[model samples]
Target: MNLNIKILNQKEINNMKISKKFTSIFLAGLLSASVAFSTPA
Candidate 1:
């Protein structure tokens, strides 16, 4: 039971890391897109 809990915790940590990475990438893309739109062609 304890081992199972540890494994689940590890999975949660990995998921959080993945989500954070994706969020950062998404934010970066959004920032660039806004800047591109604001600038003259």
Candidate 2:
């Protein structure tokens, strides 16, 4: 299915990119921390 979407301005696009990058990094760190705590050395 196709949906109509509005275009984003340059500043908005840049903000979106930065937020997504930050979210990925945060998730990765959380995952690593959980694994470290759950697994025995």
Candidate 3:
């Protein structure tokens, strides 16, 4: 039972890390895209 709880907590931590990475990447992409779109061609 303790092992299962530890596994669950580890999974949650891993998921949170993955989500933070993805969110940062997504926000950076959006910022670059906005800059490119705003610039005159």
Candidate 4:
């Protein structure tokens, strides 16, 4: 039971890392897109 809990915890941590990375990438894309639109062509 303890091992299972540890495994779940590790998975949760990994998922959190993935979520943060995805969020960062998404925000970066949005920032770039906004800059592109706001910039004068």
The candidate that achieves the highest TM-score relative to the unseen native structure: 1
Could you tell me every candidate's TM-score relative to the true structure? 0.75, 0.67, 0.72, 0.73
Given candidate 4, what's the lDDT at residue 28?
A: 100
- TM-score winner between 3 and 4, please give it: 4
* Cα RMSD to the true fold for all candidates: 1.3, 6.0, 1.5, 1.3
Worst 10 residues of 1 by lDDT: 31-40
Query: Over the stretch 2-21, how does candidate 3's per-residue lDDT look in tens digits?
Result: 99999999999999999999
lDDT of 3: 0.99
lDDT of 4 at 10: 100
Number of backbone-clashing residue pairs for each candidate, in the order shown: 0, 0, 0, 0
Candidate 4, poorest ten consecutive residues by summed lDDT: 31-40
Candidate 1 lDDT, tens digit per residue, 1-41?
99999999999999999999999999999999999999999
List the candidates ranked by TM-score, beginning with the highest. 1, 4, 3, 2
Predicted candidate 2 versus true structure: per-residue lDDT over 1-41, tens digit per residue: 12323334656788999999999999999999999999998
> Which lDDT tens digits does candidate 4 get at residues 1-41?
99999999999999999999999999999999999999999
Candidate 4 stretches greater than 4 Å from native: none
Q: How far in Å is the alpha carbon of 22 misplaced in model 3?
A: 1.1
In model 2, where do residues sit more than 4 Å from their true spots? 1-8
Candidate 1 Cα errors over 4 Å, as ranges? none
